[model samples]
Target: MLNEEQAIEARATLEELHVEHRDLDLVIDHLLLSPPPDELLVRRLKKRKLLLKDRINQLESALEPDVKA
Candidate 1:
């Protein structure tokens, strides 16, 4: 369980990560459009995007309030 302050901070971090992920997506697409795409760079960016997605999922789960069984 997160305190109110911690929750707020986590939400802010989540937002930042989402923005970065979206930006990376755009950059990757643009890079692929250029002739002779850089395979290595694209791979690296994809990996980073995956990591951000994982983190976003984890944070979202954390933010879910517990339900009584």
Candidate 2:
């Protein structure tokens, strides 16, 4: 469970990452459409996007209250 301040920080980070992820998607799409696309760079950007997605999910989970089983 995050305190109020921590939760606020997490939410801000999440929003930032979401914007970045969306930007990466646009870049990737443009790369795909352009002739002679650099496969290596595209792959690297995709990997980074995946990492950001994982981090976003992790933060979202942290913001949620834990349930006792």
> Whose lDDT is greatest here?
2
lDDT of every model, 2 decimals: 0.97, 0.98
Q: Could you give candidate 1's per-residue lDDT for residues 43-68 as a string of tens digits?
A: 99999999999999999988999889
State the lDDT of candidate 2 residue by residue for 1-69, as single tens digits: 899999999999999999999999999999999998999999999999999999999999999999899
Worst 10 residues of 1 by lDDT: 58-67
Root-mean-square deviation of candidate 1: 0.9
TM-score of candidate 1 against the unseen true structure: 0.95
Q: Cα RMSDs of all predictions?
A: 0.9, 0.7
